[model samples]
Target: MTVTSAPETYPETYSAGAYWGARKESPEDCARRTAGFLNLLAECDPFLSHWYTPARSRRDARKHPLMPPDVATLAELFRRGMNREPGGPAIEELGFRFSFDNGGATGDCATLRINGGMSSEAVPNHCVLNVPWRGPNADRLLTAAVLTKAVRAMVLSWEPDWALAGSSAYKMQYPEPDSAPFSLGWITYLSRRIGTVPPLPAPVRIEPVEDRGTLIILTPERFTVANPEHVALARRVRELLVQAGLMQ
Candidate 1:
């Protein structure tokens, strides 16, 4: 019920027409891009998540029969193409149209609580992005927020059955206790686990258990690479949003 960090956007639901288009990529091309992303992620940091190579190998090598990676080939129908319809939901005050499909979330200063269908892996989905932001990055935040929706759609397009991809969540705590993390973050693919749910990546330690369940947390001060490639991924993600017309 209580949220850790972020602002306020009340729950408002509306139907949306698909805003995504389609793009076609050859299998070899998909592999090259997957491999490229793996390399880019490594460039963002050194110690790899043990899950990276295996996931890429299976998806890129054209192994996963069900997994047709729509990572970069995200057409208009590619990801969160839901709100582009003529009668799509719009933020009247701000004059920006948005749609809520997966589910809702509450944002606090440093933490987030993903609600309903968005937090269920069994539902066949992708990781919901819940980044915290402030005044200076308002535009960035708006675009990033929309970007989050599409990215999840993108992730699901690739590995819709990712073990914990759509199922779990991470929350950041402020006024962090001696045991709790001062902040939290995860790599893009880290949420796109290929097979069974794996253990938490390096730099991430289990904080004290909550009444609900044990949380996958990151205490950046101690864990150097809690999110080795988030910055890089964020930049690229923005690019994707712009190209997809979710921004501007």
Candidate 2:
């Protein structure tokens, strides 16, 4: 495993706040719940073998840009994704000990994410798919069909009764985690750690937010534009949002 720089080191312990819902799962309890969910996933697909959450991945996800950006919007996304509202002791984020696979035991996959969050964000339902640059299945996992099936099974694991939402679109990213500089090499995680320059323009969602200038984000999926100029792109973003049913 190549060294990864802290793209953005979020506080080790998040403060208590209803801002991004609550983190109530004790580490041990959380682990137990994760195990149960993985077993449930096994029933969905025999190839859905071997699942465990990676501590580093969970820590990284905590800093996800869209995380509780605005509680109201986030809650709305959550309701749509989970078919239930946020708050309560349900779950905030589901990082099943990094058990994101359903393509046999070869570890041929990159990332396996489900909409465990209370919010599904802008892409119908949110998904984060990563294809490691140097994995055994690197060549075979390069098609949409493989990814779609994985995404579908993920939904089933958590919401077996709910009809899958956003079947046509799946949020995906091909991140070379081991040696990649996420955010356009500005953070230089790989460089600082090892002597690798992550290929760029990095996979990040960028758009101009009204007059807020251009905002660059590494969303779970959708919009991977890098360093867009605000004056030149905000108007376009609004129009795109409407077309995508994200805005009025």
Candidate 3:
């Protein structure tokens, strides 16, 4: 007889995302945006610098470098990523999607998934950045200031309707109701199209992201659900934001 134990699973990692509605664009257009985003992301942290193209296997994927983003290579990648009906033609109304990751240590690796160039209102376009949790640099890299900049970079590159950066665990536990237009995070960005950001409580600061949108920071440190005070503050701020017509 033999006994085996499952590998220990770590806590949910943090993520940064930008979401937006339909915007008709070409493969080239999406490539340009992706290139800009990768360049901007590299400046956010050393852990997010090196990136590789996707392949049949991680080992194969690592053979290709995606940094110094080439517009032609990215454009072809998006073209190949176009949404297609099962055994049918490409879905024109849908969009393209591609993923890449920094190839390295588990603790330092980061992933980027992008869906864009959609022309259908029903199909949302988004860019998501998955952060590492157990790596040596995770603690130092996961800060309010750093995540805030990461979120702002998303806004600048994607011009999304909204953007958020925070812990996946906290978001799941304190999931915003369906009535709320968007979820609250350690850092949230609301485009001007949504509405003006109202004055919020102390420790909660608001800043403009150029003329595009407003950036809301809940705390100056890492927000953890383990802290009751952190949870409480987030709820209060969310309430105010909803009342101000920012979330609705």
* 2 or 3, greater by lDDT: 3
Per-residue C-alpha lDDT of model 2 across residues 1-248, encoded as one tens digit per residue: 89988787321110000011223333343333334444543443333443333335544533443311233433343343333235644333441122233332233443445343333222222233344333445434332333334433333333221111111111122122332112121111111111212222334343322321222232223221232442124334334433544322
Report residue 60 deviation for candidate 3 (angstroms): 2.2
lDDT string for model 3 (172-201, tens) is 888876666678899999999999999999
Q: How close is every model to the real structure, measured as TM-score?
A: 0.20, 0.28, 0.93
User: Candidate 2's error at 129, in angstroms?
Assistant: 5.2
Best by TM-score: 3
- Residues 1-248 of candidate 1 have per-residue lDDT tens digits of 99698776532111101111122333333344343433332232222111211223334423322123234432212222322346676222221111111111222111111111222222212223332233332223323223233333333333322111110122221122343211122222222112112344444433321121223322233112234453343334434434544333
Tell me the lDDT of model 1 at 42.
28
Task: Using lDDT as the measure, name the better of candidate 1 and candidate 3.
Answer: 3
Model 3 poorest ten-residue lDDT run: 101-110
Ranking, lDDT, top scorer first: 3, 2, 1
lDDT value, residue 223 of candidate 3: 88
Q: Model 3 off-target regions past 4 Å?
A: 1-10
Against the reference, the lDDT scores of all candidates come to 0.27, 0.30, 0.87
